[model samples]
Every structure is written in structure tokens, then in C-alpha cells.
Target: MKTMPVLNTIKKRLSAFALGVVDLVVRFKRTTEKMFLPWDKWVKPEGSIAREKLFSRFPRYLKEPAGSVRCGEGWYPLVWDLCTAIEAMEHLGMPRIGHFKAEERLGGLFVRVESGSFIVKELARDAEHRAAAICEECGEPGSLQLGHGFAKTLCQLHAAQRKPHKVKTVPIPENLATQRPKLLFLDTEFTDFDYPQLISIALVAESGESYYAELENGWSREGCSAFVVEKVLPQLTGGEFFQESGYAARRLREWLAGFGVPIRVVTDAPGYDWVLMLDLLHHELPPNLYPTPLNFYSESLPELRPLLKQAHDDACRDLSPHHALQDAEALREAWEVMKEHLHPAILRQYLKL
Candidate 1:
């Protein structure tokens, strides 16, 4: 009966050795580590394995491959020195038994003898494909779509789309030309009066013989009818003296770009209106605008009278402050009130008129 225990022990030892061989073969065959895995996954590093023991010590191999030590799909074979074989076994859970290099098993995983050569090639190919798909504009993944309209692997949102150009027209009054540069009148309407939140800008500028303008985005309910009536009409008619809004600032910055000269953006108070212009030019305008500081301050216009009285009364009674468009109109009215009283040369020094 005692002999039966010894005989059973010998049988168990032989079974363990056989099972280890199976672990080695299955892991070695599926070795694609030389090729790139998907971006979402990572591989265990090589060189983490200790020296291999004789087949007897690993008794669990007799039963089955350990469910706890299951191999990941991405693991590949690497062989040369025992150290690499040991690394594959311990770190990557790969086969380390037998002379795989001599048997040509290693060649199945890698073209060369280098340990990580397979992974290197696969990763390189994936990187090149990713780089080719990136958009030059806006710098977001798949934002730009170019070339073919069909036969694609990635989603449309990840692709870039081309945008068209649009341009609009606005008039510049002849009277204000003498006090400021050949100016561009810009304006914007917002859905709300919230700071740093702009919905759209309406710009008007003179290009050589004709005037050009455009709106950045179409006006919304929060920005349109009331804004045009309360804001736009006042500036055009010279009923108010200040209309400091996002639309005005955008146009001012755009104008400053083409002309190398600094522009004096006239407002009712140079201090108040100019401050708004500086903020728009420095912080809000696009990179193409290339804005620098320019002179801004309220230069009292020639026409000062019943208009000022009305403006002051409105300011006191309305509670809500009138902005840039109103100021544009007020400036026009003020000039009409005093244009004949001012020196012609001084007017010529500041304005194109």
C-alpha cells in the first residue's frame, strides 16, 4: 500500500512537466507582440522573470494552466539569452522552456532576434496612421475632413470640414471722418449682457472706394430686434453718445490689422470707450487682427446742447445705461453742434475728413 503512494507521486510529477510544455507552446504561437496593439491597451515589460526551476517544483502545472495566470491576447514570444526567456515567463506569462531559437519558434513572432522588435514595428505603423488622420486647422481629432467623400474607417465627427467666406456693407458718416481715422464701424449683438460671452459681431469698414461689412453669427432673440432698435438706431441717428459693445470692438480690431497706423476710436468719453476697445483688441479679437494699443478718449464734439440735456435726462430716468451705438449717434450730433466752431487743422490731424 505504501508503494502505491510513491507510484502515484511519480505519475503526478510527470503530468506537471507535460502541462508546462503546453503553456509554453500556446503562448509562443500567438506571439504578435512585435506588431502594434490598439491604443487602448498596454503590454507588460520584458525582463521581469527569475531563473526557471526544474519541472518538479511546479506541481500545479500537472492539473491545468492556472486560471489566475491567464495570458493576455497581446503577448508575443521573445527569445535569445535565458534572461529574455525568463522575462517572457515571469513578466509576460510566455513560454520559456526548450531551445526556441534553434527550433525556429522565435522566428514565427519576430523577423529579427531583438527582444522587443515585433512590438516596435507594430507600434510604428499605428502611429503613422494616426498622424495622417489629424486635422491642421483647429487641432482637434477628426475635425477636418478632406479628400474622398466615402470609403472610410473612422467616424465623420473626427474628420475636418471646409468653411466658406462671407462678407456684409455698412455706411460711415462723412462728418466724423475729420476727428478719427478713416474708420471702420463695427458692432455686435449678444444674447445677454454677460461678460466675455459674445453671440455675434456686426462689422462695417471702408475698403478703398467701397464699404465692406459682415456679421460673425446671425442674431438671436436675445440679441436682435430690441438690440437693433434700442442700440443700432441710436448710434446711426446720433441720439446717444456711447455704444460700447462687442460688435464695435471686433470691427475696430479688424480695421487696425490692414492699416499700419494706430486708430483713434472716438467715443463720448475716450477713457470709457477706449477702455472697451483695448479689452476687445487685446483679449477678444482673433490672431489675424494683430492689435496694439492706440489713442482713445472722448473728444468733445462741436454740437453740444439739447442733445446733451436729453442724454443726461435719459441717463437719469431710464436707469438702464445706453451703450456704443447711442454714443456713435451722440458723437455725430455733438460734431454737428460744434463742427463750425473747431479749428480745421486740428480736425484734419485726427480724422480723415
Candidate 2:
């Protein structure tokens, strides 16, 4: 009877310890789910039964229940197939996907996974390629359609609803061309907007001398954006224009040397085009080339934007736009048309004319 109280006290303590352990495990599981599952934060499609089934079947891969699927209903099959493939490989030492998000970008499916294996990546790539040909709105055969400032993969019926915007063209002002500093209008096509790697570059001088080259190597086709693959790659003329990167750089240097004067570089996208050009030159700018590049879309030249667009439209009427040489030539034409309309103060501020 004396030892019965001690036994009862020990049993109560043991029960409390067990309960505490269970509570800690529950908290840890919740924390892990919150940390690894990000689908709840993504933009999901409405009334997606496939998404619900995906989450239900792959609780280990997709832990979030609240968020909708980030893509259209047409892509549900692709996502489902991709997830099924990934699940099949989970036991084979592949890294579990901590976060997953799928969306349409540049008329193609772009799937982002925080962690995965080589096979997983390949599966994702295959799905994206398939998505490029399938309509995002409905499960129908489709092609990449280019609009005014957007691109989409749509079937004939859906594409009919989204017509390309027409831009008005204006006549070039021939008499008021500013002639000084020898401007070289530059343009470059690259792999993608997020991380651009130069595929081709072109420079069109004010005097009508032009240089254009396509890189023979140093860029992977897999890294190109859907927009680039559809719009830019088809325009490449791979005869004499294609050269190795080092040879292209050397040839570009030689071309700059031929000018025999300090050339001012101008581009609409100085951040990308100018940076890539500098990298191609090995960061050692030629003495004849100015250190700073002039941006045609600079904030100081707000009045020139409309005219520049019109001139580009006019120039591109006969020539294609995505081709680097043609784009550079279009930039030169825009500059020719814009200079005549710019106030003297603005011209002096940029060109010192």
C-alpha cells in the first residue's frame, strides 16, 4: 500500500512524456509541410480536377491543399504525366521536389522545380516541348503566336480572337540628320531575357557600313526561350555568317579598327545588348569605341519613343525585326527619324550635337 502512490506518480510522468513527444512530432510535420510545399502560393487554375487528383495521389511530392494549379486545364494532362513519371523515380535515390510551379511563359510551358534529378529535368523538358505544340487554353493542336508585346500557344480558333496589334509608320526626316561622333547602332539576340547569352550580334554604322555575325558555339539550344526558338532561330542564315566565338570577337575588333574613329554605340537595350557586346570584346573595349553606350529609350528622350517606334515599324516593313542586323539597321533608322524631332537641348544632352 505504501509503494502504490510511488507507482501511480511514475505512471503519470511517463504518460505526460509520451504526450509531449507526440505533440513535438505533430509540430515538426506541420513545419516541414510549410517549408517544402509552395504550391499554395502559386496562381492556380479554376475548377481543375486533374490538379486535385495530382495533389491527392502524390501527397509526398505536393503537400499543399489550398493553392490551385498554376497552369491552364489543357496542360493538366502534361503535368499529371510529368508528376507520375517523377513519382515512379522517387525510390531510386532521386531528390524529392521541395517546391514545384508550372506556368505558361512565351507560349510554352515553363516548369520550375526547386530540387530534382537529371531524369526529372529531362522529363520536365519533354513536357515543356509537348506543351509548346498543345494549346494552353484547350487540349488541341496549336502553334506559337506572336502578338504586339506578347506570345502565346493557341489553336486556330483561339488565335483568331487575339490579333496582332498594328503599329503606324512615319516618314523619315532626311534633312535634319545629326552628323557627329559616328554612332554605331547595335542589337543582339540572346538565349533568354532572364539570363541572356549572346547568340548573334550586329552593329550598323551611321555611314551605312554594317557588321553582323552568328555565334557558331558557346550557346545551347536548350537554354533558348520559346520566343527566341520560334521567332529568332528561323531567321539565321548559317553560311558565312556563322563563326566561332573567338573568331567572331577578333573579326569584330578588326571591323571596329577599320572605322578609324571613336565610335559611339547606341542601342535600345543597353543593359543586355551593351553588356553582351562588352563581354564579347573580353571587357577590353577597343580604343575607337566609346566607353559609354547611348540608349535610344533613355528617360531623358521621352518625346522620341513614339517616333522611334514608327521608324522601326517602317524599317521592319521590308526587313524582319528579330534578325540582329535588321534590328540594328532599324535602330539606326529610328535614330535618324527621332533626331529631327528632338529638341536641341535633348540632343546636346545625349550627343553633344
Scored by TM-score, the top model is 2
Worst 10 residues of 1 by lDDT: 67-76
What RMSD does model 2 have? 18.0
Clashes of 1: 36
Backbone clashes in candidate 2 total: 2
Per residue, candidate 1 scores C-alpha lDDT tens digits across 1-353 of 79999998986675555445544743463265435654222232343322122112222321133201111111111211222333444455543332212111111111222234333233323333442333222223332222222211123432211111111112343432333454433333332322212332322333321112222322223223454456543433222312344455555555555565333333333332333344344445433331322222223333434444455454434332343333343433444434455577755643534
Off by over 4 Å in 2: 1-179, 342-346
For 97-187, candidate 2 gives per-residue lDDT tens digits of 6676677766679876666465556667668889998877676888887643456677887665333222222232333233456889999
Error of 1 at 353 (Å): 16
* Segments in model 1 whose C-alpha atoms lie over 4 Å from true places: 1-196, 199-254, 269-337, 344-353
